[model samples]
Target: MLRTGAQYRDSIRDGRRVWINGERVNDVAAHPAFRPLVDIRARIYDMQHDAATREVMVATDATGREVATGLALPYAKADWYAKRRAVDTMMDAFGGVVSRLGDETIGEMWSLHDGAGVLTSIDTHFAGNIQPHIDRILDQDLFHVSANTDPKGDRSKRPQEQDPDMLLHVVRETDAGIIVRGAKYETAAAYANQAFVKPTIANWGDAKLSEYAVGFISNFSAPNMKFICRAGFAGRGSVEDYPLSNRLDEIDTLVIYDDVLVPWENVLFNRHTAAAAFIRSTLHRYAAFPFLQRILRFADLLIGAALLNVRQTGLDKQPAVQDKLVQLARYREGIDAHLIAAIETAQESPGGLCMPNQSLLYTGRLLGCGEMHNAIHLARELCGGQICVTPSAADFANPETEAWLNKFYSVNENWQAEDRRKLLAYARDLMNSDYGGHRLTFHLFAQSPPYAQAGAVYRNFDWERSAGIVARAAGLSEAVDGRKEAAA
Candidate 1:
């Protein structure tokens, strides 16, 4: 079921409505805003079929059918390692980072599969769709993304008090399926094939069942879907001046459902408020691994850019510069350690799939995301102010300014003007440009806000065990010790 790059390119040309920068995008695969990522995504598809890279890119499902390595359910640590290799290989081939590609979002569905017991008690019919939908991903090689947050206008009021369409909800029921009317702000909905749509809020306000507490699989080809995307960085600047921005900016979209029909078979949960809470709590159980993994690569970028900048100027010999490089190194290793340890301590989900250790995932995400700005600042400091003041690629090439720029930029025999310009450009795009700011903010809140990320760690951590250990050490009252033991 491995898809070729060409096949992936053709799949998104189904006349879906998509707009960006005040213009309609007739063809997402060919449009400048999406084409770069679309091509990278296509290359990911092609990797699994290429003989040289197939070993790491393809995996055998339970049925022995070959599927994309990233889509397989993790039943063992080795499966996770293979996925790591696949993501690494993809980034290497594309020379950039891409997080939303099916690998990261697939885990949201996996979380639902683990929550099947909760769904079954809520509604048996919708409960049955979990495993089958997961199987479909492996069978069809679907380019799946996640849909969680809605526009959520007027946070002060409930859905009933505000415009209910602000949050996605099931508007009506028909014999064929449930008709949903609302919208979601999805990252790649315009280019992706499908999305697992669900509630964004944690509290249902004691409701047992509500129209908004629904979860279902949405197809981009469904009727009345509209994609309103933010302006992308790809075509906004020259690749020579903004390499990372041009190559790696993933255009995000506000996807409007506009009364689309979701078949009963595609529905994972319906009117189960408990299902909503359960999903909110566990949505990133497996997904966070890939998200956090992407940050690891970003760490490499920060370190590489800063180190190259310092080395070109012979500033690396200084003790101050050396200390700063170590700081970047520590940040990189910290994220890498969490990724490796999460797999080492992986546990089986209730639905019989292996998920990364929860504590490590949340803690690592917080560590990486929480300090993203500081890390950027440290790297930016090491890069010096030259990155910000450097001449544009155009200025460097112009005959009038070429010699003067080269005379000033070129350092020794090894570091030429061109190489120095490229380094500064690379570092600038990450630390001083519009794309740098966008990405820093993106990572800071990628999973959720800081409080939410800390809350996840708070809930998943074994605080009970720690409390019980303290009880034993302090010789607390018998009741307190007994309660702690019972809870543990």
Candidate 2:
């Protein structure tokens, strides 16, 4: 059933134990920092019921029950349906709010973990801890955030050798649940959601397992779960200055879990190293493909923004501008091609859920990182100094500056300077903000490290068969006479 925005809001109103700075937030819905994200998510929920978006965002479940794209797509046909669902998610994110709406991404990641859990006993942790949260959230169309990577004090050492608290660990276990202590850094959007899931990345070894292999879901407002939001861009000397400076895309947070109690139901993987590894690997694969698709969609927007800049500045007719635009188009087309290839080569899991071809999917991830970087750089180059010099929205309202801006900033005869400037500013925000940087970081982080990613591609590929065929053809060229050989 499609949930109303009000229903979704009311559902998450249940008291949570979230803390921000030093104060406890009584209601996330009422908090200023969190409200905008909630509003965005509410917009997504409302889209499920919208006649325009319903076809794309809503799908029937395995039981033939209607569910949101979050629930339905992971189990979908691994084809255009799955790809379309991913596109719908990115479109809903608007300004790439997933950094704040990390829960939605993690929720989808957990679905893959859950499917993997069904495959091996090693996946029990995911089945127990992560799957329940996914099921619950999917049923309610609940939004969530996630924190995964730890702050390694030194890159050379493993989790056990590092400060125990550097990585979130189960410090104490009680009848009620486990008391988790430590902090997870780069925890995107933890402050804006009802709850956040923490999944173990990869298990380094047995001894480190207890300290690193814990996975669970916790309410953002859970006791001792403190959030220190990264300072946003454009902070003025005044409170009002901060608002204008803060972009909606800056949703990353540092989540400190100070002896936070996570109940049994929330404990997805507790010291089960094997299960932890499988859950991590499976979720990584499952989420990465969809994430690549979303990045491609975002790239499309960046392309559109760049095109707008070119048209607005009358650079559309310039040979240089046209060349850059064509280059940008090729980049976008390459990404789209990879996405189509991944979808076309998709396969079904043993559990009957369809998934993209991992090889093609990872190729998309590689393309996503490089293409986005190029897109952003080309956009800046195309916009030239206008992107940097555009007056603030507030400046346009000042009568004195308004007249000058109107006279000087106009790009075309028909459009006012302020209007043209506004378009450029929006383009600048899309390509130049910290949020823009975060999007690039996300694409880079989506796949395993470059070497590992290349290795996966090489190892899984069938080069041996092709090599054998080539070797046989080469041997055939070296003729041997059977009777002569016997005489010799």
Candidate 3:
């Protein structure tokens, strides 16, 4: 069932409607803005078939079918380790970070799989749809993405009062399936095969059933699905100056659903606010691990850029500079420690799948995302002012001023002018470019906002044990343990 790179490319050429920079794109795989990421994604697919990486990237299912390791269901700790290895291998192959790939998005389906029982309790009609889709992703090797954020017309007015289609809703149901009308802000939607579309944060009020409470898997190439993507960072500058920007820009899209039909099998839930609420609360339960892992790798890039900058200028000998480098190292280790601990103490999910420890994972997410801006600033400071004022690669190549540029940029026999200029250009793109700023914002809010992260930690952390310990320390009577039954 493992697809080749060519087959993967052929799947997305199904005439999906995609527009970027006010022009219609006939082939997303060939478009300059999307081609880099598309080719990287394709290479990941090819890696599964390559002799060197086939062992790490592909795994056998119970049925003896070979599947992409990234999409396989987790049955044991080894499964998790394999999945982690696959992600690491893919990133290593790409030479930069690309977050919206298949591994991160597939976990959303697993999260829904964990909630199958709760979904069944809410409505028995659609409970059976969860596992099949999860299996479909594995068997088909599909590239899946997520959709949650929608443009709500007004904060105060409800969807019913204002534009009804502000939030995605089920306008009507047909014998074939349901007709949905709305839009979602999704990353990698234009080139992706499918998206698990769902509602954003919604206040259901007292109503048990609302039209806004809907979740479905939509095919990207389906009729009336339009992908309006943000202008890509690629092709904005020479690749020599903006290497990371050109190679790793994951273009986001506004996916518009103009009365699209969702087949009955694709409907995960409908008209059940409780189901929607349950999903919203636990949406990132499985996905957060991969999402945070990307940030962890990014921390390495930050530390690398800063340390190289300091070393190139002989600033590493200074105590203050060394201390700053240590700070960045500690930040990187903090992310690593949480990830290691979460897996070591992994908990079993209701669906009989192993999950990263909920408490550590959520708190880890908070720590990694909450202080990223500070870490970036520290890295920027350590990289010094040269990263901003450095001359371009073109200037170094020009015969007119090449000698002067070389004389100033060269530090020692070991640190030649060309290497120094390359390092500075890399540092600038990693920390100071528009791409750098966009990355900061993505990590901060990609897995919900900071407040939501804190909320997850609050809900998952064990408070009853601490409450009991405090009660015992204070010598409270059994009747004063803050129990309603004891008070009664």
Candidate 4:
């Protein structure tokens, strides 16, 4: 069912296990570190009920019931729609800071397991891991976080080769469920979510370590689950000292599970090695699509901001500045063009779900990373050092420096120097601050390494047929020779 923003908020407030630092967080709905994320999630929930976004955020299920798009949409179609909706969502909210968290960004990942059947095989492991969570989370509009990649103590070693605890695993199984003991690092929005879904990065065998391979969903407030909050740029100082962007926190965290009990119903896949494998493949298959939308939206914002800065600084008339602006516009168009291409080339899977063309999606993903970096660089170059040299908001309130600061900082004759500087500062913060840096890192690390990502693209492509076409064009086909000889 479509959930209202208030319902979503109240559901999370009812009960959930979440910790910040060493203390148990009694009130996540009101916590400084988590409130911003909650606010963003609420906005997404509100969109479902809004007349304008309702069509995109709410869809009719196979059962013909109106449900939250997050729970009702099929994975393939959902993946495509999610990317489109994400662009609108980001644009509606101002930018990535107020945008939906990545975890919530791809809610249809759960739907990938809907028809995968039992999780006894290794190939189906990933689906097995997620199936249970899908059922549990559907009951309420819960914010779900994923923990798949573990902090491998040694980069070269596998989970078994390294310290067992280096990756999360189930230590024991009871009639109630399984007991998991280990830590999951780099979990996005852990404190803001109601439940955390744990899945193995890859499948593993050996009954002794099989628990580590199991996938399950558990309440964040489940017994023994601890949240160690990561440091945040905005939370480091007093509100007066922080920038306007500081209030919107997107902190990475470590989820410590010390013998946390997950009930059987919550178990999506348990020691079924095959199911775990399928989950990973399915996730990898659609991983690039969402980021493509995010990058496109970001590019649009960057271009708009750059144009504004140019006008504000009276640099629109400068040849070099205009050229830079043109180049930036082209870059934005290039990324967006690829996204459209990917969508146009989409195909349906065996399960009758639509998925974006893999080759085009990967190309867009890599291009997105480079484009975002370049966009930021262009903003900096066009804005000049004044982007960073602008005084703090506090300086405007000071009686002594106010007038002089305004006079010198003003760029265009008609624009108030203080107002122009403030706009530039906000843009600069988006381009220069830790918040900006985190987005860069997220894009870089979102999927596998660039080389691997490219390799997947090549592997998925139908190159043999293209090669055959070239061979035929070059008269290299034996059938053509045979026909010519017969005629002679």
TM-score of each: 0.97, 0.83, 0.97, 0.84
Per-model C-alpha RMSD: 1.4, 5.7, 1.7, 4.9
lDDT of 4 by residue, 200-226 (tens): 455354443365666666566566766
The reply for model 3, stretches above 4 Å from the true place, is 479-488
Worst 10 residues of 3 by lDDT: 479-488
Model 4 poorest 10 in a row by lDDT: 99-108
Between candidates 1 and 3, the one scoring higher on lDDT is 1
Ordering by TM-score: 1, 3, 4, 2
Q: Any residue pairs clashing in model 3, and if so which?
A: none
Q: Any idea what lDDT model 1 has?
A: 0.89
lDDT tens digits, residue span 1-488, model 2: 56787876776576655555566768766666566566666777787788878777777766677777654545545435654664556465564434344433653454445455453465443364555565666676656655666665666776567687877788988989888988775543443444444554553654534656777776665777666665444332222222222435444566778888988877766776665565555555556655666776677767777888778767799998999988888887887787777667777765555666777776766777755777889877877777766667667678878888777877667767766766676666666655566567765664455655565566445555565566566774432333333355
Candidate 2 residue spans exceeding 4 A from truth: 11-27, 73-86, 89-120, 123-133, 186-203, 206-209, 233-247, 446-488
How accurate locally, in lDDT, is each candidate? 0.89, 0.63, 0.88, 0.64
Error of 2 at 14 (Å): 4.9
Candidate 3 Cα RMSD after full superposition onto the native fold (Å): 1.7
* lDDT, candidate 3, 297-366, per-residue tens: 8898889889888888889999999998888888889988888888889999989888988999999999
In model 4, the runs with Cα more than 4 Å from the true position are 14-24, 51-56, 74-87, 94-111, 114-139, 186-188, 192-211, 235-244, 272-274, 475-488
